[model samples]
Target: MSLGSHSVMQGDNTLRAWRTGIDTYQEFVVYMRRDCPACRSEGFTTQARVLLSAAGQRSIVATLSVVEAEWLSSGDAGLSESAWAALGAQPGEPITVSHAPPLYSLSHVRAKVYGHKLGDTEFAEVISDVAAGRYSDLHLATFVTACAGDRLDLAETVSLTKAMIAAGDRIDWGRQPVVDKHCVGGLPGNRTTLLVVPIVAACGLTIPKTSSRAITSPAGTADTMEVLAPVDLDIASMRRAVERTGACIVWGGSVRLSPADDVLIRVERPLDLDSEGQLVASVLSKKAAAGSTHVLIDLPVGRTAKVRSEAAATSLGRRLQEVGAAIGLHVSLRLTDGEQPVGRGIGPALEARDVLAVLQGAANAPDDLRQRALCLAGDILEMGGVVPAGSGLTLANQVLADGRAWARFQDICAAQGGMREIPVAPHRQAVDAHASGRIVSVDNRVLARAAKLAGAPTAPAAGIDVHARLGEYVEKGQALFTLHSQAPGELAYAMSYVASRPPIFQISPTGESQ
Candidate 1:
């Protein structure tokens, strides 16, 4: 069989490459655009060809997502994957890709990315693709990874932030200086939004704080908050609550704050890959579009948490602060302890109970959660430039102790539909330690996976509720952790998973006991 160049008809661009192999693994070629130099940088890039009847051209274009190969780690692979998906071409189906305009080429930035701002039309095309569900998760991953690491210069971050904002619905509060806060979350139970919003509103700030349901963890702020109140409110309902009470903590997933973000997150969550640049963009884009004037970023640094060291935290902190300034907002990043989960509770319903207890001033309210919330609220007050530095913490504590935050919380909850208690799953089993000693470490990722095994987030009530934390001493027979599930089978599955992956936690001093 002869392998050689074949000129194929396409609209504006020519696709040419050596026909190298065929049969079994599929016929293959090394393709390149003589006019576009991007292919040269990453060997040969792949582009799937799709044939469309003249009238069918509109259908194909409408169904396709924008593909920019130059910035991807495997731009060639990404382009091949997305284009193949777009063509809806089967294994044996022939495809001819028409030469159409490239949505927004990264070729210009390939020189060194000195400065590049997307024009409106180009911006619209990418958003259209995202909204249309045209791109696969991996393709989205490529977009995120290419932008990973390093802070985009002020001008670039600002432009990208604005473009992301324009990509989705804009909430006009008909007011100035909307208040919001976000944690660069890794701590398991740092459910501060459950407390901060009420305090800020009580202090006369319009905080329509939208949170998320658990993506990977046992719970999210929305999940915990949902235990005491409704979190999945419609956009109109959410806006009305904020308009009426000056604060609302509803889930953004329901209202679509930045829809493109939700799609990207679905891809990133499983891959466990949140590239640095994408993270900054994802966090700030939502805040900017929410019309927030001042935002607080919680950076929890710990040995096992998201940012493992103080140095890492500070580097991220500087980027967030500087970028916020460029985008015309005041951003304050706070460093918090993330050595372990924030509160005594580890799952959704349990965390909700903790939130309510704090609000109602229960004598045994989770102190750790309370302190975290106060620190965040205080910084928020300082950012508003209303509570002077050094005075904000004192004021935040006062709001908590005086019962004003509690009352405001109740009012906001009632406004966000109505308050109720969600029941924890009744089926449960406990895991006791095999030996006695101080709890040396708790592997968060493993623990999170175990919770998933037990049926968390989906099961809602079913999750591991840790009775012991790091440094706590326990008897050999004492309960190390408890697994709750909707069914006995699921509970057993969790137990089996735990047994197979031993030492989710380590006990000190070495000795087998009762």
Candidate 2:
């Protein structure tokens, strides 16, 4: 039987065949045709289809899934499973086979260190297949690999973003310059979004920040905000929340924003590959769909962060700027230091505590947290033209200190659901400074890991709240940090992990410090 240009001629007629094991199936499986001599030659394979068991029970097959000829007209590799069954085969069977059956379309090129760019049509088809769920994990891998290693151009980035937006729910706020800000994440304790949203909203701008739950980290913006208020608002309810308060912090995962990107993210997370093209599309499409006209993107660049080198950071920054403009979004990128996390809290509840402190004007609100929030808010302010040029920082600070930001935050949370105090972990574990000096560097990744081991987003209260910061002097016996946990065992486990590790805190020998 010819599948296409070449005949599916039998390669071998001998008894010799490669044996393969069948999984979870009680009876053996193999392919056969009712009309073939080979089918007649093997009595069991000849029947139209029949069940054979050790008990000698037999059942006749009336019909199969019946995939028609259109599916199998081309290469058998692309053949539908129903077509395979129609030709008579069980998937796990050890069947007699021939040479490669007229399939000449595939190329087996060895992949290089970095991937090459895919054509626009090819890329769109790949995304189409991904969106339609026609591609399996392996096919998705090929799609991702083909476009990996910064392989997309500015137009491609814009196209991909538009495709992603088209694939998901789009929010039309019917307002010009609807503003949003996104952090290309990596710095742990960078819970600035919680502070940024309220401040931007306080300055009479519409800011709807839809955040993600943690994938590999201890906490995400959604996770930290979850510590303060409910974040799982649906599309209609969420829009109402934003309308009532002029701002909303909702969970993006729940509302299906850029849904295909969510699927890609799941695979990307495990592979540890953040493809620049995919990253750009994922960010901007969500912003575009959310109806953002102005976007301030915070790209933290350092050795340990997402965009490590300045060269990579600069390239990414330019790409973001260009792509945003192409998509009709006014864009600005600020590269902050990823050498250290921006806040003293390293988990959801702990970070929520830090944010609340900043909002409520607590005496112990972290200066780094406050400063970054104000700076990012200032950028949004200037970019959205909420404040005059050169005075973004001053305007932001005034709104924050004079109780306007806090008041707005209260209103927004109440509009969503009432504001609640960040919950405290009933169990507390304190770690004293091992060697006191001027605090230097803190490894946020390790610290975040330790917090996860304790209990995080789930435990709400379970996390690390740093009592010390860079350049801060501490006594050897003074408490360096506090670990909060809802359970005693979790507190113990978290404490044990912290104890086994060397000083997460880097301190200088020189006593004189700020």
Candidate 3:
């Protein structure tokens, strides 16, 4: 058996499609036994890019993984969960495997590697192939690395953003001034989008916010939002939520907005490389694709944060504005203090609790989270013309104080499959202060990593909950932060990491517990 255009290569190249049920996130994988007839005749091995064609005209290029298990017969070819979904394969279906086609876009990537700037058409060719899943993980990594460390100039950045937007669906709200907010994330527990959305929506503006999951941090807006409400809504469901409540906070990937950005994120996540141009494109492309006319970006600058310094923030902020302008978005920047995490929680469910506290006006609510949310919401309000420039903060405060934001948030959550109860990790351990002193500084990267090691985002309830703040004095045995994990193993893993590192929190001999 053979496909017409994508015919099988010489030898018996057909195999029965078997579902292995392995989930590799978004990376597609095809499995074959080392001694399989097709593997031997076709010279297939691990990491080999193979073209797979299934029934109903479904096909995908997947990285090959050789298996030696007896359960997988030589005649059977296993497909990972991602590959299975991509091919829409059925059990015992016929599958034809062949060499993946040559990638012509890599030449542009090669040119980029040699310090040559790419044009719009070149970037488009590369991104389109990326969005179509034709590029392997190695190729994706090469392209990403070549673009890292300020390699892409202003023109290239704009072209890349345009290419990204063109690679996916774009929402046409058919209206002016659709608003949204995004944070150039690095600081953990900065889940302000949750508080800002309801506030802005309460002030009579449309905020169809589409957020992303974590790329290089413990949790992102979408991750924290998912802990409160269902975030993986389809395009129609997302529209209904926005129409019914004038706001929606859903994961952008589900709706296929900026599909290329989602693809690029698969590599960027592991590399921890949210590069300059790629980052601007990633943020602005989604905002532009979401049909947001006005956007407020929260750029946090600190020594340990993503931006690191005021100069870097300023440069990034300028590029953001320029790219937003090019993409028809009025981008506004707000550089906030990124000295430490925003809220007490640094994971999905943990951060959700803080969001709920702030929204419900709980007495123990984190003031920093509330105020930061208010400030960003106020900027969005002013930008969208809901209130004047100087009065936006007051109006935002009034909406939150009067419970309008809370009520609106409840409605939004109810529309998106109702609110969920935040989960609690089964295992908890506290990292105590080594000696009585004032907490001078907290390392954002280290804390975020610790939370990730505790199984955050993937395990929504697992993370770190901060109990101490900068300038606060603590006793020798006092808790600086508590590690929460769903399993004792995960808790131990995070504890081991913390144990082998420098103190996450710097302590001074004298001060006043804040």
Candidate 4:
């Protein structure tokens, strides 16, 4: 067959598209036989960038993944779920594969790599191309790495934030002082957004909060909230929820607010890199797009947290304030203690239980979680002018104590969707204390890693439950923390990690732990 403008020219190279049902997050991917006629004719190798078009109507650029299996015929092409959705193809639609167009924005990326700052227009073009699925994972990694380690100056960071906001839909609440909160995350079990939203909303403030899923940690706010209520509300549904209950907690990715942040997050998480400029851009863009006028950012600083030193936290906080102001967002930064995890539970369902316990005023609620949430909510209340500076905590406490927060929480949950009972992991095991002594320092990073190994966030019910706190004395056989997993293999893997590492909880013979 002769080659068309967008078709590969090889013997019978018109391939049938098959859905692989593989989830690649954001990047589109296509799988084909390594020795297929189209592959040889088009000079396509594994990981080559290719343009896929179907029915002359839909097209997307996807990275090629060559297979050496019989599952795919020589004339068949497999598309990942992202690619399938992008193309809107049927089960057996004919697909044409061709070379992708040159990425003109990559020149800007290269410039940034060479220590040159990108102009506003350049950043806009790059963000637009990235949002349009024109950039592959490789390109994305280069952009992320180039901008890492404070390489993006303040002006460039502001420009990037604006570009990110412009690349996606923005929510307009049509009201003044739309309030929200975000945590510069690192500490595990810091699910304060779940608590702060209810408290602030109970005070009759508009808090249409959008949260992200876990990237490197055990659970993100959305993951914990998902254990209680559906968090995948679309824009209309989100608006309805806020109209009904004055608040909503939904996953931000579903509403396409600052969508490039989501795409970049997929690349940034595996590298475990949260560059200062990118973090500022990522946070403020979402807030600005969500129509937030007043936002409180919780910055946790500790030796093991995201911002390890006070100096670093101060610098990040200043940048956040300056960027938010530039973008017309009233940002308030609060540096909180990040010496350990906030709540007793460090996973989705486990953390959800902690949130519920605090909201419902259960006697056994974790005090640290409750106190931290109250403090943050107080700051938000003060920022929004709900109460005076010193009385925000009193008012927030009253709302929680009088059952108003709980009622409002239930209303919000019902509005998002009907609230559901949080699940529990089927398999559980406790890591015992090695010796009887006072608990010293806890490595937040190590604990988070163990929870991830236990299948947290992904498994929803999987994570670690800390039973011992710093300075608390424990018996030799006492439980330091319990591991919860849906699968026994995951539980064993987490346990193996704990076994091979230095004690996650340091024990002291005398004196208080730092």
How well is each residue in 455-482 modelled by candidate 3, as lDDT tens digits?
9989999999999988888999999999
| C-alpha lDDT of all candidate models, in order | 0.67, 0.70, 0.90, 0.91
Q: Across residues 446-502, which tens digit of lDDT does each residue of candidate 2 receive? A: 777778877886777788877777678888878878888888898899889888887
What does candidate 4's lDDT look like per residue over 204-275, in tens digits? 889999999887888988899999999999999999999999999999988999989898888988887769
Which has the higher TM-score value, candidate number 2 or candidate number 4? 4
Output the worst ten-in-a-row residue range by lDDT, candidate 1.
20-29
For model 4, the run of ten residues with the poorest summed lDDT: 1-10
**Which pairs clash in model 4?**
none
Prediction 4 TM-score vs. true: 0.95
lDDT tens digits, residues 1-514, model 1? 2122233334332222222122211111123343333333323233332222222443242222223433322112112333334434443232333433353433323322343444444444554555445443444555554444552444555555555667787777877668789988777767789899998889888888888878878888888787788888987898889888898888887876777777677767766774554576678877876768889999988777889999999878877777677767788888998777777666787677777788778998878889889989998887777688888888889998899999999899899888886677888888899787888777676777777777777777777777777778888889877888888898899899998886777888642221
Clashing pairs in 1: 11-99, 49-95, 50-96, 50-97, 51-96, 149-277
- Provide the lowest-lDDT 10-residue window in model 3: 1-10
Model 2, global lDDT: 0.70
Off by over 4 Å in 1: 1-128, 149-156, 510-514
